[model samples]
Target: MTVVIGFEGSANKIGIGIIRDGEVLSNPRRTYITPPGQGFLPSETARHHRAVILTVLQEALEQAGLKPADVDCVAYTKGPGMGAPLVTVALVARTVAQLWGKPLLGVNHCIGHIEMGRLITHADNPTVLYVSGGNTQVIAYSERRYRIFGETIDIAVGNCLDRFARVIKISNDPSPGYNIEQMAKKGSQYVELPYTVKGMDVSFSGILSYIEEAAHKMLESGQCTAEDLCFSLQETLFSMLVEITERAMAHCGSQEVLIVGGQLFVIKSCRFFFSNLTIFLFSKSVEFHRFCIDNGAMIAQAGWEMFRSGHVTELPDSWITQR
Candidate 1:
């Protein structure tokens, strides 16, 4: 079986993973948690990755009981992410590949998530709902490509949630989204938020703006608690996600839906939506947190797939992009 080591520092998390064929041998990651009322900065996040990536890589190798020489290839996320973070991980991957004399693969971040979801859940040809801090899209495989059927016109869903969390000063230890989800469970009131979905795309900036203003007014007037606002935001946004996913499913004529990305963790908790569809939620239990957030295992898996398909990237072609 082909062995691969993957690096992922797309946003706030820095991860290293080792995989053999489709099986993940090790997955180690660290998230850069900013304080309440703040969001992650690319420079700071990149510095965090640069500081801890080697430690994370060593831990992954130790966990897998493998040496640098044992790995057949090295992979790193190449695009659709924060530039500084992506470049940080890419430099590390390139250094490791050079040191070990291993082939290097530049993987599309979105494709990595989709490939890992497919590997973990074995959901063939399913409509995909890819939601994360940096991305939100409904995708389907067509002619060897994951085509975007729908997407966000403005900020991503997770970004909106994170920014909203900042408005209410929520903890960012694990994630702003997870904290919101927990607080929402305690919420009994539902505040109305704007819902904007135009054709196949969704927009979150308007909703985010509206909620920020409403939360401020409500807090000032003693009309609502943070929990109530969190609950309302989750309900409104997740309902929109469910609606769009169903629309994509209907258009693609697929019975199975694969939910992947950091936001999938929150979405999976929406039992009301899963009950209505044949949903294949990846990394549901095993390493649930790792898979839910961006991790090296997905990158390793995607890289290995590309290697098997005879794809390799030279150092000259290893530039990063934020699409």
Candidate 2:
């Protein structure tokens, strides 16, 4: 069996996956998010990664019934992630590759997230909607590169959510997304927030400020309930994303909409609304939350593909992280 190990440490998640042959021996999985209270501290994030990277790797190898030497290749995320966090994972990968003398591939974090669904679902040439703290874009595979049709001009969706949660002082446990999602669920009313869309691209920086202002006013005046504010924020931002994604689909004249990212899993209400889009749009593609977050499985799968396709250098010194 061809065994490949994948590592992903973009943003707040540290993920590892092992795939054998063409099948994921173990589903692409992640350990957990940032610690309680603190959220997205770069130093803390790097430290957490270092603490668990080896443990998770060991668990994955045991689960796959394979040792490090049994790994035919080592694939790890290299870029489009928190630079310090990526270094933590990449160094581990580098060490493994050196010790085992296996082929090491530096995988793009964004591409790995996007490719996760493709690896799990075996879809080809699907339009991918990647939503996360560090990235928000609708990508379509074309030519030799994935084309970005629509993306956030500034501030990603998850980042906006985290900032909003902090503004409201929600517990950062589990995640800002989970905390905010709970708040929205508890919400019973809605308040109006600014809705801005520029062509096919969307902006959330302004939205965050708008929510903060509205939330501030509500807090000072005691006019809007926290539930109302959270609901309103979710409504406005999700609408913007749905609108842009629909527009991109029309522009591409394609039907597939594969979503890849972490926060996508938490926005159940938004996903429900996005489902309504299917009634009007054509041929809704697979939108599985299995690879919802960036993890090792996606990176491993992408790296293995690259290795199989002759897209990577087998030499050890040539494998460089593209942070």
Candidate 3:
């Protein structure tokens, strides 16, 4: 069986995973969480990765019951992420590959998500809705490449949620977005936030600014609770996402829709939309959700795809893209 070990340190999270012929053998990760109202900087995130990367890598190997000799290939996320963190991961991946005498591969972060989603769900030719702190995209597979049909024009939906969470001083222990999702469950009022969807593209900067100001003014004046603002933001942003996703699906004539990324809370936010569209939840279990998030197994899976397709990265070309 083809065995691949993958490294991912794209943002605040660092992870390593091992996969053997489409099956995940081990996946371990650590998050670098900042205090409430504070966001993680690239330098700090990279330092965090540097501190714990080797430990996590050991854990992945032990959990997978594999030795360095058994690994045939080494893989890592190559870009569209924070610069320092991406460089940190690339350095480790390159070192490991040379040490083990294995071929090295650089995988695209977005393509990793799509590959893992397809592998786990076994969905053929489904339209993909990828939402995360850094990216929001509606994609479809065509001509051997994942094509972006719709996307966020300004800020990503998850970034919007995170910033709003900071504005309201929500805890960032696990993530600001998760805290916002929890608070939104208790919300009953709709504060009528701005809804901006242009054709297949969505914009969140305007709505985020509007809500941030409204939250400060209304919460101080006893006009609305934090939960109400969270609810309103989730509803408005998710509706925009749903709108563009539906448009992409219709345009692609796809019957299956796969949602992948850190923000799977879109399910609770847009459950009603599912009734009209054929949506695949992948799985409702916690493992499924974890797999959907940023992780190394996805990168390994994508690397396995590329390796089988006759792709490899030379030592000199394994650079990262920090877009």
Candidate 4:
């Protein structure tokens, strides 16, 4: 079995995956746990990426029982990621490729998420809804490229969640979505938040501000706990996203929809968004949960797919240092 190593450390989480003939052998992710009320800082995230990437790569190789010599190729996310973090992963990948004289392939991070979703869900030619800290788009593969049919004109889904979590004083955790998911599960009372949808693209910036205003009003009025407002906020934003995704799917003439990104782990926070879709929701669940986040495995998967399709050339030095 031909083995390949992929590197992912574009933003906050560092991920490494080992693939054998397009099948994942190991997928691992780790986040630099930020203190309460703090979203990821680029420099801090890059520092963390440098600290942990080697360990992850080694562990992934061990899981596959393959050494650097045994691997045939190395893949890394090329662009559309943080510059410093991307450089760290790229340096490692280029060094590894040079050392083993293995082919090094670079891939797009956005496309990696989409291809990984397709690979895991087997959702052939379906519309993809990618929601992450940096992105939220309704996309479809056509004419040799993944096209974004619908997306956020403003803030990304995960960013909205993180910002909202900060307002509610709950950002000590690695993922704000997880914290919001827990809060959403705890309380009641419908505080109708802003519902803004601009055609196929949605905007969450206004909603984030609205949720904060409502929460503050509730506190001043002494009507509800922070948890109640959190519940309402989750419900409102998720509803808006679902509405847009369902509409995009309809527009693309696809009944199949695949959800990809780290935020999907808090299914509780977003599953309700998909409640209105009448078609069968094919799970885009990867072979490993860690691959769900931004990481190396996703890049590798995309690279391997591109390579098999004869779309790539070995260039260890070709790296996307920035978006």
Candidate 5:
């Protein structure tokens, strides 16, 4: 019977949400989108979060039919995200907690995604693939901690896709990854790209470098289209992801797989391509879209879980982490 309000701005998106008893009451978020050939800077992203946070907070409260005084706790992402953005959201959370005379809780950004996915799918314990702009990991829960079975060695898959989109000058209206997915649908040829998987981990920097060179050559020689490049890149990278995920599943002995984060939408076309894997695509669920990204509802839910488990941050102990 706890009512928690969460704020999340760990990256480019700013979100506000309310949750009660493991159920999301309201989740509202906004992303800071840049133009073609541009990447989001931390300072600019933080500014966007600061600008729209109050409005989003108001909307979330209204949607939840609750007032600030009704909230029992305030939660916010503590880290593993951009410093400026994380600090911005943390500051807001601290302010809200103080103003409302509510307890404050700091949540891990990655765990927030996992907990929200599990809450939505009701999968007892599933192997998780957490893919986002800044993170890529295959995780499993054991002994109360989420252990990383496989992860990226270098750049994250989503970051690589975003950089590739910049090379091709794709619009960032919705997202670069979404644009790449759409363009990849038109591709008929599978241009070979490097696939680097080291043991349980994968690497994407080399692939990104190779694709940048290929893109330049294609543009110069008029031999290949951007769509073809997008298609080939998606095929190669997604195959690597599936392969590693399968290996983790086999090792962990889990039949259900939960996928979370913004990049999940990019690989929706290949969802059924994995054989024998009962993928509980959390992002596909109608009510779970906001939780898929770095949103406040996930933070609130995770924080509430921690709170119920008797975990809370004292006023002087509030902090943020980059790892």
Candidate 6:
């Protein structure tokens, strides 16, 4: 059985996990939360990661009951994330691999989410809707690679939610998306918001701008509550996502639909909304919560797949990408 340790510090979160073949041994993570009305900067996020990463790594090892020598290889997120946070993870992963004399592998953050979702759900050949703090895309496996079928032409869905949360002055204790979801649950009013979908791609910048102005005016005029705006935002944004995802799935002729990144919100919006589509919702399985979101075990699992496929990152070639 192969054992792999993975590091992920691609954004505001820092996580370390170990996987033994198909089973996750341990996954531990910490988030860098900003105060209300503020967003986490890359430099601050990286600093937070550097502060807690080693402690989290030790926790993972302890939880997995494994020593460094027992690990077969080390893996880390390589790209499509904040540069500072990605580099922080890559540097630590490289150091650990060299110290342990283990092979090093670099994983794509998006592929990490996809592989982990597949691992947990066993949904083969599903149309994927990947929505995160920084990424939004509809993807399908084709020609030996996961090709983008549709995506955001501007900011990601999660970013839209986060920016809206800032506009409304919501606390970022757990997450902006989570806060918005909670607020949306109590919302009754459906304020009109712009819904922009350009062919296969969607745009959020316009919606964000429009809502920012509307939120200020409406909240000041006592016309709508913050909850109302939150609910309206979710409805509009998720509808666009569902529309594009449905279109992509139909085009790809896929039966299974896997929701990645903003799992809870997307699942709520897309589940049972698509006629005759097999929706794989990970939220039902409590064990999948960590895997559903950004975590190190996903990175480890992706790296394990790559390593078994004879892929490895040499020391000299290890680098980060912010695609």
Off by over 4 Å in 1: 264-268, 276-291
Compare candidates 3 and 4 on TM-score and give the better one. 3
lDDT of 5 by residue, 1-323 (tens): 99988888988889988999988899999999998999999999999988999999999999999998889899999988999999999998999899889899999999988888788878778888788999989899999889999999988989999999999899887888888988888988888889898988999999999999889888678777888998899888878887788788779867667778766344554443343233522222212112266778989989989888888898787899988
Q: What is the lDDT of every predicted structure here?
A: 0.85, 0.75, 0.85, 0.75, 0.84, 0.85
Error of 5 at 217 (Å): 0.7
Off by over 4 Å in 5: 270-291
Instruction: List candidate 2 segments past 4 Å from native.
Output: 27-38, 264-267, 279-290, 313-323
Write candidate 6's Cα lDDT for 235-274 as tens digits.
7887787788778867886666777773335555443234
Stretch of 10 with least lDDT, candidate 5: 282-291
Show the colliding residue pairs in model 1: none
- Score every model by TM-score: 0.93, 0.89, 0.94, 0.90, 0.93, 0.93
- Candidate 4: lDDT over CA atoms? 0.75
TM-score of 6: 0.93
- What's the count of clashing pairs in each model shown? 0, 1, 0, 5, 0, 0
The RMSD of every model to the true structure, in order and in angstroms, is 3.7, 2.7, 3.5, 3.6, 3.6, 3.7
* Residue pairs in candidate 4 whose N, alpha carbon or C atoms collide under 3 angstroms: 7-296, 8-295, 8-296, 15-296, 36-172
How do the residues 15-122 of candidate 4 rate in per-residue lDDT, one tens digit apiece?
899877768888887877887777777788889988888888888887777777877778887877788888888888888888888888887888888778777767
Residues 1-323 of candidate 2: C-alpha lDDT, one tens digit per residue: 56778888877778788877667765434444554434677678889889888878887887778777788888887787777788888889888888999888888878887777777666666677788877888788878889999888988888898888888777766677767777787777788777888988888898889888778788789887887788788777777877887777787766566777877434455465556557546455534332475667788888877878876545454333534
Which 10 consecutive positions of candidate 1 have the poorest summed lDDT? 281-290
